[model samples]
Target: MELGLEVLGFLLTALVMIIEGIAVVMSRRPMHSILFLFLLLLTAAALFIELDAVVLALAELLIYNGGITILLTLAASIEPEEIRAPRIKPDIILPLVAAVILVFMISTYKFGNVSNFSYTSLGTFILSGYGILLLVVMVMSIAAALSATYMISKEDVGI
Candidate 1:
């Protein structure tokens, strides 16, 4: 009975993620798309929790849902009138791509030994070998945020 409930919960979370993912792609407005993306990431974090990857779940919530989504929302809010207009026509390609990704993830979940995955080991490996790469990525993210802030300030100053 417990296992059944877990499976049901997992399936429901996956369904919600798929729907929100589609909504994110189909949204005509940038803000609406960002909102859907936020929800999708939240669901992804829940999925991680279901998989017993608590560290991953926290990182997903903090990094993607908290930081990236807020940054994107701010970027969208300050877009120029011409740029705000939706340029990409709604197409079937996005949904197809999402489906493919879902399939791939499901297959990986079924075949991969997720129980053996250790966040501590991964962290150690990254810190030992790719610490510089991680530092560079953080620097780049900070630079991007600063650039966005500068652009927003300049626009406000009528520059």
Candidate 2:
């Protein structure tokens, strides 16, 4: 039963990642692509949690899914529609080159054996070190959202 559930979880995670990857690349609208990317990050975070990498999962959720996703969504919403659409057909070479570089980097990397990699409890570490930073980030995100709302609500002279 447990084994079956684990297998199901893994399958679902892989499916989510595959779907997100395809959707992100095929999406024409910038906002849609960003939304798909956010989904991808969320799936990745879930995968991390399943693997018992809770810290990594939290990082993925808090950083990419929360911070970067919000910023990208805001930018997409604020940008002109014409600019949001690709002006030129994307060149294949750039992505190909990037893929090659990524593959090479991954293949050549060496993860040295760590005999001891200990971490403090998440609660302790957060409260001792990152607690204040987290609060500040939350406040900043709220401020940004409020400012964006104000900017959008303001009457445009050109409109």
Model 1: how far residue 124 lies from native, Å? 3.8
lDDT of 1 by residue, 1-159 (tens): 566766876777787788778777877788768877876887787788668686787899899988999989888888853345543433553455445445534543543345666666878889999999999999998998898789867866554
Residue 28 of model 2 has an lDDT of 83
- Candidate 1, 74: how far from true, in Å? 0.9
Please list all clashing residue pairs in model 1, or write none if there are none.
Answer: none
Tens-place lDDT digits, model 2, residues 17-91: 786688788878887678678767877776766665666878898989889999999888988875455422335
- Candidate 2 — which pairs collide? none
Candidate 2, residue 10: lDDT: 71
How many clashes show up per model?
0, 0
Tell me the lDDT of model 1 at 107: 48
